[model samples]
Target chain A: MEFQEAWPYVVGVYMSIWAVLLIYVIVLQNKLAAVKRELGSLSKAVERKG
Target chain B: MKKSSLILASAGALLLMAGVYLAFFVAPDTVVRIDDRELVQFSQKIFYFHVPVAETSFVFLVLGGLFGAMFLGTRKRSYEQMSYAAVEVGFIFVLLVMITGVLWTRAAWNVWWEWEPRLTTFLVLTLMYSGYFVLRSSVQEESAKARFGAIFSIIAAVNVPLTFVAGRLDSLKPVHPKVFTLQGASMEGPMLAAFLVSMFGMLLFATSLYIMRLDLLRAREDIEYLKEELEVG
Candidate 1:
């Protein structure tokens, strides 16, 4: 196949990959909520232990 | 811009140009079997960029393991965040490798996937690394999560090279079936130049991404710290 004909495959792959990345980033942001809550509670414990 | 970003961006551009030039011009075009009957020409050209960068993904996987081990040894949370960022990048690159591999397989083998040894190893590696993130998220304690994440990262990383070696071993079954031996890898002048450019460019790109993600994670940690400080004050 010629380069022009196969170029679509590359583009499609790129697009799909980016979509997955976007979903991951969103999930990461959601995950930060858990991190923040842990930090809130854990720092208090660290302070008390010290 | 940060120093690392500046260096990486410039290097990535130069490398990208060189790799592209070499792949399109210097390397010889390949004719691969598209199907039992049909053959695909020029489709094999993707190897120059696809294979080397695919190989480079291992760098991040190992880095993730090292940082995880460091965190466990020192009980430092910085190491956990660092490991997390690296694994995130590693996951992205692995996905890219799978996509490129699938494309190559379709064009070369007329199939999307097979349970071949190397490919299966990669699939397992991907799952193992994903488990690292999942394990981290499941626990609630900050230090425990950090410690657990670090340990998991090390274990997950150890799997990557073993997977690679196992895959290579499986490919040596010449007695059962004949396989294409890519014996001649001679690169013409232009093809070599293009390959160098692309590989270097990708390296830069991956580096830039690593730095950016690390910074983001650090900043998030800082904000959490500040909030805790305010509550105490």
Candidate 2:
């Protein structure tokens, strides 16, 4: 069988896998950034109180 | 990323690329015997990645359940974090498995979805774990959330075996192929090699992701603890 016939399905499967994983990685990164910001603010508040 | 994790990730990426190349170009195309006719199947190539991803998901879920059990026994926050991270990672792999499986079914069986035993049970397993997240969010108290999550995780883990065995029970005409056996696999030569490499690559990728997620969770917890301590001081 020619690859052209099944190319769409193949591409769809591969692309979906990569896209989902990429989305996860991006979400994790965003979360780490948000946590860092929160930690910075908390540390500054502690310093001012001390 | 840590140096070791970076190396592992790079190796996994290279192996996965090689596996894909071998699956499409090096491995010989397969033919399926159906109704006394041999049909050349191009979509069987998806098996290389699909099986590995499915297996990875199963491994992570089992680990998640194990950690959940440990959390219940020890009441350690770390165990709960590990359980949550493992389940989160497993969810991603499960999503991939369903997407690829659907595509394969459409290509091979000429149907997008069916109420087959394996398919139905797997869907149930997915829903059960998804409910775990919902359960966690619903509980406001830390101890209550962890306890409920642990109990649900164990129950969901028990369902894994049922999901796996559902298709093999009667075996009169299962759409899912029983390829792996106790002694050996059914595939041969290049096809088997490609599958093995892909499986290794996927396991490595899953492990690295799990470690990264666990670290992130721990860091978040540490920050929360520090904030609490500072407020107390």
Candidate 3:
């Protein structure tokens, strides 16, 4: 196939791979942050109870 | 642990970027001619990332099954968590492989999808592992969930070989090229080098991600333990 015709598929594959990885990373980061916040609150609650 | 993970992540990122650069600029383009028309298969460049990610997914799936088996034998929470994380990452990589494979198929075979053996088996493999998560969430009890997930993961791993051997099982034509053999790759020098670099980069990246996910899961578990202690106090 011509470069013009094939370039789109190449670009699509590259972009999709990166986009998926980026999304997964972002989601993991958010989950980590949420768990950190929960840990903080739990620690404070435990301290007060003690 | 955090410092080491950060180092791994940085190195993985750098290697991945270098691999991408090599794929686009250094690897030689494949040329094909059909019906008196000379065409450049520029889409072949996708092979570098696609093959590596697909292989990485298989590796992660195998690791998941290994950990699952260990969890079943030892009844350890840590093993189950490791198994779960590996399977999760494997699922994501497999999804990317499917998407990229479909795109490459469209470019090469002029079709979005086919009912070929390899393709069909791969889809089945994905679905089987996907059931792992479904089974995990459906159960309410912690021990039951772990036991079920571990069993399913081990059983699901059987599909990996099925997927890999699908193309070789029959006389059916396969668009997916068998690049590797006992004699090494059928590609040119630069192309093979690019592929190797990309594969290494992807493996490193996947490993880093797995470590990060495991750490996060451990942290979450610790938090839960603290929460329970706080409530009791």
Q: Pick the candidate with the highest lDDT.
A: 3
Question: Which residue runs does candidate 2 get wrong by more than 4 Å?
Answer: A44-50, B33-38, B171-173
**Ranking according to DockQ, highest score first:** 3, 2, 1
Better of 1 and 2 by TM-score: 2
Superposing all C-alpha atoms, what RMSD in Å does each candidate have to the true structure?
A: 6.2, 2.2, 1.7
Q: What does DockQ give for each predicted structure? A: 0.15, 0.52, 0.68
lDDT of each: 0.69, 0.84, 0.86
RMSD (CA, Å), candidate 1 to true, equals: 6.2
Q: Which candidate is the best by TM-score?
A: 3
- State the lDDT at B202 in candidate 2: 84
- Write down the DockQ of candidate 2: 0.52
Per-residue lDDT over B1-233 for candidate 1, one digit per residue giving the tens place of the 0 to 100 score: 35786588678756665666666656666555555754446665666656655655788888888998888788777887888888888878888788877886665556788777677777888888878779888999988888887888888888778766655464543111112235643655666556656666766777776776776687677766766665666
The candidate with the higher DockQ, 1 or 2, is 2
- TM value for model 3: 0.94
Q: What lDDT score goes with residue B228 in model 2? A: 88
Scored by TM against the true chain B, the candidates give 0.84, 0.94, 0.94
Candidate 1 residue B49 Cα shift, in angstroms, is 2.7
Measured over the true interface residues after superposition, the C-alpha RMSD of each candidate is: 6.4, 2.2, 1.8
Give the clashing residue pairs of candidate 3, or none. Answer: none
Residue B74 displacement (Å), model 3: 0.7
The deviation in Å at residue B135 for candidate 2 is 0.7
